[model samples]
Target: MPGIGPLLGAEFLAATSGDMSLFGSADRLATYAGPAPTPHDSGRVSGNLHRPTRYHRGLQRVFYMSAMSSIHFCPESRRFYQRKRSEGKRHTQAVLALARRRVNVLWALLRDGRRFEPAQPATGTA
Candidate 1:
């Protein structure tokens, strides 16, 4: 809710219909939303992951757009994205990774009926 504004919030609500039960887990929701790449297994050749053909395009767009916006509006999200970028991930790849991560956070928030809060930075003692 903090990073997501009215339009994106409405899109998310419409896409999910405000129903978290439909997805038993955040991974399921991410898969449905088209962010989690599906694995393809065929005999000896395995470990091939690709975007699912059968997925909610609108839902995917909602997550991508919201993740992009969150980079500026949410410090934690921005840091995550930057970390991904620093790891040699391209722009789109980083955004997609962030979007996938958001799916987990959003799922937990919806399940527990809690609001979004920026994660506090960890403090290290010398």
Candidate 2:
């Protein structure tokens, strides 16, 4: 929600048909949005993953753009992106991971009927 603007929000609603019940879960929504990679394993080639082909590109674009924008405006998003980079993921991969995470967040918000709230930093008392 932090990165979602009016246009992105509209696009997301359009892509998802404004029915969270259709998705049932965040994983299903991510799969539809193309951020959840699928296994491409062969006989001896396990552990390989690839982007799904039969997904909604518009939805994917909405998530990707929102995730990219969030990196600049959201501290939580920036830290997640930075951590992914530190783990040796490329920019696109890191962004995709962030997008997947955001899908979960969005799904939970919709399911719970609540607005987004940034986490408060923990304080240490002497």
Best-matching candidate per lDDT = 2
Cα lDDT tens digits, model 2, 13-119, are 99988998998899899888875666989999899988757999999999999999999999999999999999999999899999999999999999999999999
TM-score of each: 0.82, 0.88
lDDT for 76 in candidate 2 is: 99
Angstrom error at residue 121, model 1: 5.1
The global Cα lDDT (0 to 1) of model 2 is 0.92
Worst 10 residues of 1 by lDDT: 1-10
Candidate models: Cα lDDT each:
0.86, 0.92
Worst 10 residues of 2 by lDDT: 29-38
Maximum-TM-score candidate: 2
lDDT of 1 by residue, 12-40 (tens): 88988988888899988988888567688
State the RMSD for candidate 1: 2.9
